[model samples]
Target: MSVCKERAWKTLEELSFIRVAGTQEELKAAQYLKNECEKAGINAEIEEFEIDMPVISKATFEVLEPYKKEYHVIGIGKSGTTDENGIETELVYIENAVDVHLNHVKGKICLLHGRLNPELSEKLIKAGAVGTISIAGSFYDEKSIADELRPRNTFGKGGQLPGLVMHISDAEELVRSHPAKVRMVLLQDAEKKGISHNVVATIEGSDLKDEILTLSAHYDSVPYSKGAWDNATGSITVLEMMHYFAKHQPRRTVKAVWCGSEEIGLVGSRKYCETHKDEMDKTIFNINFDMTGVTLGHEICCVSASNDVMHAIEYLAKLENNALECKLDTYSSDSTSFAGAGVPACTFARLAPMGGAQIHNHYDTMEHLDPDSFMITLNFALHFAKQLVNTTTNLIPRKFDEVITKKLEERKKWFSEEKDEKKKESEENKDEKTKEEEKK
Candidate 1:
């Protein structure tokens, strides 16, 4: 009746593949998890949700004028594409976007030091830049192992400029040689809403069936990664717990969700919260596992709840001689969606030491993960979830403090802004149509 780490490791190996959000690979992974649940005597359902999936058909970057050479590049996902031919413009490197560099970037294709975040995107828009190129990966990365940067939702905002990513080595060469002009030809298959799934399997409680305790992990990985440690580890850990809870019936309902599209901005979890609003009241707490199984990683718990819950976790970890650093702050994971909906939540992750494991790239493979390390984390998580889910009386409060509440409010602001922006865009289109009709 006890949880077995070897069984979990086998499951992890089965799901260890590059399953990007909204892709067929992602769906394949979802189906695999559902099949596993069915085999374990639990009925699972694949709940579909819509997400933006950009397919980059062509992305080419070349430095002209100063040096004529082509380097490898990838189109930023969801970042708009260029015209039929392409764009050739003066190239500048704006290290930090200072006022002097901002003025220099006007009508030029600029190379930024890192990924373009929202604030930088806004500044680029203000600076009237034509396009952008971001540098990624270590300088030591060979062309064979260079990480390709895909467009993210963060790059799809109003002020975002079309962008491509290049290796840090190429960037260094370009900066050293001072390329005056560059040509960028980026094309993408038209973007549309694509479907991703949330694989949900439930073990209904014999006593408190109404009260729910959900266990979650994002099974989807980023591009070019097998994601053994970044997520398949977490997904399989929850499956192991589900296997245990299925044999040992809990006092409260326990649901295990293998979320898709979490790497692309928590899309699956947000959809779950939105569709299951009526069940939110019944959801007592959410325990999310993400990024584990690294040989040189530390177990960390981030509780997006009151200080009392934080203390409870700390005390329990100490009582069990578990090595974890628990803190009271929001962790960026699928758990954010549950906490935003006023359901107390916490996320447990085994943070790999710097240079020990590489996530979001091809380096994140099974070779980087240690099964023994994963077992240690799995044992601690199982102990914690079991005690909370089978509590004789509900001593844990579900209310969140100002700190957690404020984080949720800030996280939810993007939804409001996006709605407002869409409304305004629709109205503007209507006005344009009316003007064209009058002219006709």
Candidate 2:
């Protein structure tokens, strides 16, 4: 069946409210997703969890000018005691907060180029950045991508300073507004704690029912970002796939997971795995779809650390693009949780920005989505699931190295066949040229 790009983009465009870590908007998106899954005929349900020192939406803040609201502080922030007047420090531009220069951040306000990586946030806080300023570009469509891309917008007050992230242009304008030793006095909610839930659905197989395969995507997004591409694309992709598969039916028991709080340190995936370690341990593989569909370039790349999984994914994407190569040992996504544990797993995405990173920008929106890419990914995943189901003897095979080696061997034969075809084409061209010269 044809999946309409206009319709898919419209779906993401309408849910501009979804953000990460259990906000009202996120819940709304979740409910909408659950409805979609049910409508498509998939059995779906919610799974909840709690995070200690959670940087959820409730611990919200904004830059106030003592009398008027100056900058709205979105997401998590420091909550304990502060220097009443809020630390007034000069702004320091951090090219990459994740790779922050410790010596330079001491007692200064930090301006980050992209979204915050939690690891970077902890390190920078430890480095002594009084606060943080982030730039969110215009192309951002999904909130999930923002949550993962941005530093949890959280702060643990009294750690020498606080942090806040905002759009690049808006931040530039905010920083320029009355630039005289600008002081940002924001609140930190270290004490506020809460709960978040993940929704899971299962399609049991009769044969190897004990073995399992998982398909995952975060249901949350950043507070301000609707998370269309960041994850609404991913989350929706899973539901759509689930609907299709449920009707078509696969051999292995497939679990469709709508993870929660994934935007914050993989909390949802981590918690879910922990809660179902027994069953998860039984899992042979996990297929993670983070971002799919693009109005611009469509470079569906596969990421996996295991040799076997990588070999399999790369084999699946062999005919994609010569310039766009699918990595064999790449492992960075919601699937990292399971993949890290040695359960053969990999992540699927439509595009990979030049080097080796996701298109971590707001421009990763519906405006840049291509429905054709989405359908390709959806169908490829469906076929891959079929292969995985058929290969019941080797889910997370005992030796991933062997798995990849075997797959690569097959690839060599395929490439040879391709080369032979090109040779024939060249020969045909030469023949045509010879005939023309003879006629002349």
Candidate 3:
């Protein structure tokens, strides 16, 4: 009935593999979770969903004007493609690609300084840039680490430009060389669709079953990462909570969702919210875990709900003598999706100190994680969760303050824009099909 650190660690080891979203490995991890739940006398199901999984067959970046040299690169998935000969144009290094930088990006292949976001992508496209080269990693990174450039995907809005990512070291050299003309080729199947899953397990309460308390964590890892610290620990944390609730039935229903594709823009959790929209009214609260169990880390809680909920969590931490830094802010995790759906949500994480551990790379191994450290957050969370479920009245308010409401509104706007773009594209495609049928 108690939280078992040994059992959690064993499960983490079992899931220590690169389980990227929309991949076979990801499906394998989902199945494993389902099997584990079933073995524990819990009813679990894998809910499959379609995801945009572009396949990049070929991508090359070459400098031709100053000197003829080719650098290794990975194509940005879902970024539009170019011809076989590629896009040959002047290469401009736009330091953040502000308004002034974007003014002259027309007919050029811009070398962006940082990661590309939806706003930046729209700006570059509107500026008539032929292609883009994004820089990744730090200049001082070791050669081995620098060589492994992380692969990313375009936001998939309309008119996405073909993009490539290269190592920061190579990017520095290319800038120093003052390359005038560059050729970039990116060939990818942008329309490709792949399947991802969310492993859902429910332990219905004996009473007050109408109200639900959802616990979630992402199981999908990034490429080259086993994700032991990034999320395997979190995945196990929720599973352990499920085990505890199974032994000690609560007064409110508890649903544990092992979300997939969270690395790719919280897709799994968003899909869950959209699919189960009718249940939002009864979904009282959501508790999400992103990264935990680090050997050298501190516990932090991000509440996307009202200040009252945040204060309650702070008070609980104080009462339990659990050192935690709780704040009222939106976390970049699955909890955001639940909060967006009007459910009070919070994300719990044990963040490692800088230079202590890192994620989203192969270095995100089990070395920096400990079973004892992992239990700290989970144990405290269980205590806090018990009060919420056992209480007669829902003490937590479902409303957000002005600041958090504004943030949620902004996030909703972005989601709306993406949805509008997709709808427009679908209509255009349908029109094209209709025209083709008329011609036949």
Better of 1 and 2 by TM-score: 1
Most lDDT-accurate candidate: 3
Cα TM-score per model: 0.92, 0.68, 0.96
Among these predictions, the greatest TM-score belongs to 3
User: Once model 3 is optimally superposed onto the true structure by TM-score, how far is the C-alpha of residue 22 displaced, in angstroms?
Assistant: 1.6
lDDT score, candidate 2, position 240: 66
Arranged by TM-score, best first: 3, 1, 2
lDDT digits (tens) for residues 1-440 of candidate 3: 55788889999999989999999999999999999999888999999999888888899999998789999899988778998999998999989777888899999998998877778888888898888888888767787777777777766373368889999889999989998888999988888889999999999987899999999999999898999998999899999998989888999999999999999889999999988899889999999999999999999999999999999999899999988999999999999999999999999999988678988878999998988999999999999888888899988888888878889888887678878988998999999999999999
The lDDT of each candidate is 0.86, 0.62, 0.90
Q: How accurate is candidate 1 locally (lDDT)?
A: 0.86
Error of 1 at 381 (Å): 1.2
Question: Sort by lDDT, best first: what order?
Answer: 3, 1, 2
Predicted candidate 1 versus true structure: per-residue lDDT over 175-286, tens digit per residue: 8998777899878764567999999999999888899999999999987888888899889989999999989999999999889999988889988988889988999899
| Model 3: CA > 4 A from native | 156-159, 433-440
TM-score of 2: 0.68
